[model samples]
Target chain A: MDVKEDLYHALLMEYASGCLDEGQSLIIAAHMALSPAARKTVAQYESVGGAILDDCCGKVAMTKDALARVLDKIDCGDSPSPCVQKSKSTMAYMNAPNCLQTYVESATWTDGKGGYQTISVRTSCHRSKARIYKIDPDTVFRVNTRSPHQLTLVLEGSFHDGRAVYRRGDLIVTNGDAVLHSDAEQGCICAVAQPSVFSVKRFVQQIFIRY
Target chain B: MYITATAVKSLAPRAPHSVNKPMESGRAQPKTANTNVNGAHHKSLLLRVASKKDREAFAELFEYFAPRIKSFLMKGGSAPDLADELAQETMIAVWQKAESFNPAKANASTWIFTIARNKRIDHLRRVRPEIDPADPLLVEDDAISAPERMGQQQETEAMAEAIKGLPAEQADLLYKSFFEDKTHADIAKETKLPLGTVKSRIRIALEKLRADQKVKELWT
Candidate 1:
């Protein structure tokens, strides 16, 4: 497989295995929403999980009253409520995929260097940080990666990373050495996740460059 | 959760492929003792629960799967008691959500596996965001023909068969990924294999599964 396909394959495997953190999981979930092929592959991988579970029959036994407890819970009407659907009005202005709607709705954007706005997305896993970035039309946004791996997913419009133009739902995975200079046309909104490595020099440069 | 060498070795002998012969001819072979029998039986039981709210069917499912689900949780390092609780919760979710189960989309084992996985995530104090299948922006598989859609019902069985036929090492890696909740990086660290090799092995395994499905489709 080519590099892009390879990365996507790896991501799908991790996602199917349920090993990805919340931020990374969101990205893959959104991508699957936009790509039927990815969805099919993920389903395949999950079937493998089911197969493994089936193979594991009788390894560890449950308590004898397990079924009785579950039936009691069901009879008592105490099961948790189903997931609440987002109201249409709340989803009205959201341009991101449904998987990301809640996060995007609650995020507050702050102005950043080079004519872009960003919001740090709250994530449970401390190993990585997630953020959403919005760039204006005809603007350039530069990000110097300090983490070993960074994943970017385009949510709206398009941006050229000097190699190819990435549109909505496209994912880009890069390593630390790559300096990304994204030029947006018609503006852009993207979600990014990387390890928790912040370069103080890069932050200082961005702050001073804005002045 | 840590998987000991002894645990993996004990599990390897009972891997499904060793028991089920690979499909050779589409029409000639009789159904043997394999997941297909159990899978189809469970699918019907779930459907009965969905259609009739049959407590008997639900009880049967609980008898079969609850133990497996508990074992699964324990393998992932949950305390035995916690695993038992989660397993009960997962079965309850299965009963409450039975109406939503679509055999065309996934079999009972696969469906319950997802529910169990979600419970495990909740137990870890983590979230697993997923696409809303009903999302307006979601891509539709409208191009798939009716026959292909019908073929999807068998896709899971094909996958199980495919996995059974995999090399032991690849199957072990997959078990680690799904059962132990190990990422490729973690598998590499544990197995002392390069990260790339782990990824590639998994990729190859998935490709083989897909290829097997395609071959089965041609026969259908």
Candidate 2:
């Protein structure tokens, strides 16, 4: 049994805190799926969230018709659709989580430059977006959504994030005003979720993995 | 108005003695016991919704949680209108998924607040685009049946007391992390502390929290 307790626990803490990078988040989330100890620890942090949420003690009134509207939505079957069941079952996304699938299936692929391609995932809630990307091995996938927060989750293959290697199921969340350039060690398929509108920039293919 | 006389009687021990009167339906007043959530009144209301498809019970739950949820979302910077939309969606989910509620696992507040948190996150990510990856408000199901959540039901008072006992520095860091939703990097930048120091401070606070004798027993 290979257990990276401290490493994964820290990751879980970041995840539970919602500060984890997309790549590392996917990794930790995947790791938690298989690691009970990590799951238990993350649960502790989540409970901490529960504690604070309880203490917030303020109330903002909802409109009188709010409940009626929700009931109306339910009556009309207008709630969020999970996805087309059959397409999801046959579609192979490897170890990707179900939440990832809902947005991934939203759009068709655009074009790729230098083995990197992207498709923006449409969401009904007008505030955010989900994008799916395909990156070939030995490439630096640079993104500049300029949005305050962006999450990258590796659906397949691996990448080197200038800190640690992010393999399949890894998530990396980056914030700030700087553009990011991360190198992939192998063919990587990822989904990027954000609220800002962005299209895939040009990809630079290079071999940098020290094997 | 949805709480029946029977429910008010049944939940007397769990709620403040004041709300037991039919005239004091709790519609205008939110319960003061923030810590002792999952009150029996709420559990009974949800149970009614689940078993009887009781709209009145659902209405009562909506009145209590919807506004609180809207405020919760706004604290994260959601617009009032958007927050209202998300809160509405959250209530609908509660109505649709009320059957899944298990009072033995979690209180009504923990469960309903979680739904609000998720809706807020989903809503923010759509509109704002650049949310912190480690946004501290990302909630998990807080039910007792959720493995580690089991013995925790009986420990909120103990946990609340223990939190007051934590070092001020540690508590401040926790406030920033949990209440303000600051990431370690963000906290470090704001406090001028090294990144490692910020993480360690948070880690220490968490360790102290989890190490509480009563809390430990609950988790175990």
Candidate 3:
């Protein structure tokens, strides 16, 4: 591999291992957005890591209680009932630590429709935070955070955005604001770590609180 | 790519009758097939089984994965009983979240690894004073080196063999990079080499690892 490719791979290795600093991570993410070859190489490395992990646990057997618990949960049928309709206008909030005045408030909320839901954890002032979001089976959620750093970790289901398939547990961290299209088969569940919040009003207040 | 002379002797001898059966003969080629989608597929299947409350699948998956998780922990310097307990805890997470399995975003091992990795990290953070001190480098040496430990399964054993073939210096670098998570500069300082040379050697080692068919044998 050439110097650029090598650097890209090195960045990718660090990213995969969660060792990259914020600025370095952003650079790699931007490059990945523009370069298919780099993305593929990253995928290959991830594949290698995944494969090794599999071998380490070869034919992993779930514990005896593992299945029993699932069965029990299924028997309970724990999903929120249709009768308890979620209000469309209600927005929930989870405040951050008092010390984190400069950071955006982080919250996790589930909607009645389960279609439009988000788990956001960000600094109100600084542009660095982690958020996870999910859209129901047929709906889509749009984000327009014009920040210099963004990181996403998929928690469940899948979505297609640009060049890659965002599946369950896939970490897709990027920088800047971009259009996201996710009205696919499985919907989308993602954890987003970014420098900014989705709303400007919140951003202004965040700054005020910080100062 | 240099295999120690002794390592060549450790290969399991082939059966004479294996020559007649292509399937059996091919099986001797090393166990890389299951590492890709197969690993993920099995995980998805287990998740489905959990969602559907298929007791058999759940039991089988738990039986298989729990022990491996334990083994992984044990190798990482965790006491055997504690490793087993953590493995059980990981399985509990799997059971509780079985209904949420989504194969699109992550392969199975990645998902499981994320959970296990998170749990392990959390456990270490909770228990280790060094983590709170914020000096990761000082504590890195204490972390269990994944490559050094022999796994419970055949495929992992094969991978161990492949890793053994790498040059000692290259292997050490890879170990630090993967397990200790040391950067190129840190590795350079440790090895008394220039940063550029360390980077070059690491690049070359990874390339060689990626290209070797024999290296592929253990990943399944």
Candidate 4:
């Protein structure tokens, strides 16, 4: 497999194994929403999970009343609330994939150094900080990596890095000491997940760059 | 997609005595037909729960999957009591979400497996973002024709067979990844194998499954 396909396959394997954190999962979900191929691959991986589960021979008996309790709940009309309903509003919400819409709705954007906007997303993994960046049209954004690992997924519009252009649903993975410089031809929105410590150094760099 | 009369007869909610027989018979027997037949039976039961609120059918499904789900959770290191509670929650979700189970897309085991997986995630207090299949922006698989779409059931059966055909070590790795929720690095650490070896083994297993005639015909 080529590098991109290999990376996505690895990510999907982690996803199917339930090893991915929330932010990384959101990236995969969003990509699947846009690409049928990713969804098909994820489905195949999940079928493998199902087959393994089905093949498990060990049977741990439940507590004596387990069935009775569950049946009682069903009779009592107890069910968790259905998946979050899609709300109506906002250009960004409209453009963002359904999986990312909830986060986009609650995100509070603040001004960044280079006329861009960013919001820190709440993710379950303590090791990583997830953020969404909105870049203005015709803007150039340069970021130096401090994180050992990072993932950036384009959600809307397109950005041209020195090597290639990333459009919606495309993912860019940067590892240790890489520099990311992109120019947005149109207003661009992207989600990023990286080590939490990277944010502090980036903040410091922003201050120095501003001065 | 062809449901023989015997399959339906085996699945229909029978008398209490007969319904209890399968529970007493122990685990499902390993056979190529067992997974597909059991899947069809469970699908019918789930659909009954959906259409008629059939408690008997639900009971049969509960008897079959709850113990397995409990075992699945325990393998992931959850305490027995916690696993029991989550298993109960998963069954309840199964009842509530029965209306959403589309036989065209997934069989009973695959559907319930997802519900259990999500329950485990929620128990860990982690969010798992899922793509809504109904989302307007979601791209549909137009490459598949109508006749090919009808092959999903056979594909699932073929998948189970392919998994069974895998080498013991490769199958063990898959069990670790799915049942134990271990990452490649975790498996590597535990097995004392290189991470690349673990990953490649998994990839090889998946590629083998994908190579099944039904699976390849349907998806690729």
Worst 10 residues of 2 chain B by lDDT: B15-24
Candidate 1 residue-wise lDDT at B131:
91
Could you give the candidate ranking by TM-score, starting with the highest?
1, 4, 2, 3
iRMSD per model? Answer: 6.0, 8.5, 12.7, 4.4
Q: Give the per-residue lDDT digits (tens) of candidate 3, residues B54-170.
A: 667666666556655665455445676677666766766666667766444345555555455445644664210001112121112232224322221222323434544566555
Q: What C-alpha lDDT do the candidate models reach, one value each?
A: 0.70, 0.56, 0.46, 0.70
Q: Of 2 and 3, which scores higher on lDDT?
A: 2
Least accurate 10 contiguous residues by lDDT in model 4 chain A: A202-211
Task: Point to the candidate with the largest DockQ.
Answer: 1
- Expressed as tens digits, the lDDT of each residue in A13-61 for candidate 3 is 6555434444334334433433344454554454444433454222223
Q: Report residue A68 deviation for candidate 2 (angstroms).
A: 5.4
Per residue, candidate 2 scores C-alpha lDDT tens digits across A1-211 of 1122223344466666555544335435544443345556666676665554443324677787888888788788776533233233223343445434433443455555556666554445443445567776666545544655555666667776565777654556555332333454557777765434343232112211212
Write candidate 1's Cα lDDT for A1-211 as tens digits.
7655666787788888788878788778888888787787787677777766765323457788778877888889977545555443343227777777765544456777666777555555666557677767766555555554667888888877677888887888865344343444467778877544464234424422221
| Stretches of candidate 3 exceeding 4 Å from the true structure | A2-4, A21-39, A56-211, B1-44, B50-53, B71-86, B96-106, B120-175, B180-198, B209-220
Indicate the TM-score of model 4.
0.81
Arranged by DockQ with the best first, the candidates are: 1, 4, 2, 3
lDDT of 2 by residue, B1-220 (tens): 1333344234322221111221222223333354445445667788899899898889888877787677656655678998798888888888887898765655566567556655654544422122222323223433345544445454444455455566656655665564444566677786666665666666777778878887677656
Per-prediction count of colliding residue pairs? Answer: 0, 30, 27, 0
| Chain A TM-score relative to the true structure, per candidate | 0.77, 0.54, 0.40, 0.73
Please state the Cα-based DockQ of model 2 relative to the true two-chain complex: 0.17
Worst 10 residues of 1 chain A by lDDT: A202-211
